[model samples]
Target: MKLLLTSGGVTNPTIRAALTDLLGKPIEECHALCVPTAQWGHPMCGPASVRGLLAAEPSFRHLTGLGWASLGALELTALPSIGRERWEPWVRGADVLLVDGGDATYLGHWLRKSGLADLFPSLPDTVWVGVSAGSMVMTPRIGDLFVEWAGAPDDRTLGVVEFSIFPHLDAFPTNTLEAAERWAADIGGPAYAIDEQTAIRVVDGHAEVVSEGRWFQLTR
Candidate 1:
């Protein structure tokens, strides 16, 4: 499996370069399916959220401006809502699955309810790019220690990755290195703390860190 789990979406040159490298192609030729299910977990999943996402164009413009293609938003909240027949092909055809972040529990619930988790293993060639909660849901669990930040507290996750990730370190309110360290100390297995400019890239079970900011890992 190939996964780029990030604290924030692509926002800096290092990350952009890492993504381009992961794809083994110029950013211009990539086709991404933006999964925004996480936004729904928040209180602003309506027009305001849409506008906010659109406003982030400047940050992701490296790809958008480079002739990269996108297929609107993929709402994975439910099977019928996303039209499995149509969206499934779109997801399979895309080179990258770009997932936004919000409540990890909510996103994981919908992903499983929609049967998307079952499909992940089939998309071996597709790069799974996750931002924050999007990244958290792929782990075995989202620790309760982070309840103050994640809003929801469901420990069950996709388990796509064996470890847990603590994102937005020092970026969001109440998020700090000390808090991340404490959370990791209590975790039963491996855990990592990633800042906005950092990402954890895992390929074929091997993990590597790509960052322009702070990040640390703890292992049991």
Candidate 2:
């Protein structure tokens, strides 16, 4: 699967261009699916947040409101109950998966439990557009500093990519570059600290940063 991992959604032209490149088509023509599963794992999110996303509220215009040809919801928590045979088609039919942010560990847990993680290997042409925790979930670890879910055993996630991510850099007072440096030291491996206007794009196995804002790569 191709990856367009962002701290925020497609909030800028550069990132949107990267997403379109990954999709190989216009956003209007693509059939998209929104995964709100990660939001449930966060204390600050709930029904209202999920509803706003699905309804394409102004706040989510960069994401689900991108005006796709069609849009659908895929709740990972419900997948195990229905069986993969019934849901596989739904995933296979979509052009891209818009994964919103919350807790990477929680999203990773369900991705495994729901068997979606196992399915990713076969979807070579599918595009995965991830935001914040959605982006972090693709990395090896999120670092303890970013952990917010009470149920998470640790900061580790799927490791779909070889690096870690410190998102929302400078957007939050606590997400300053100095804090990201400390987070990177804790990660002890390749990682990135990206601002809201930045993103990391991965096609095949190669990764590239596409940004209109500040970003740093840590190799400690």
TM-score of each: 0.87, 0.98
Residue-level lDDT tens digits of model 1 in 57-78 = 5544432233465545567865
Judged by TM-score, which candidate is best?
2
lDDT of 2 by residue, 83-148 (tens): 999999999999999999988999999999999999999999899999999999999999988788
lDDT assessment of candidate 2: 0.94
Candidate 2 lDDT at 206 equals 96
lDDT of each: 0.75, 0.94
Model 1: clashing residue pairs? Answer: none
Judged by lDDT against the true structure, how good is candidate 1? 0.75
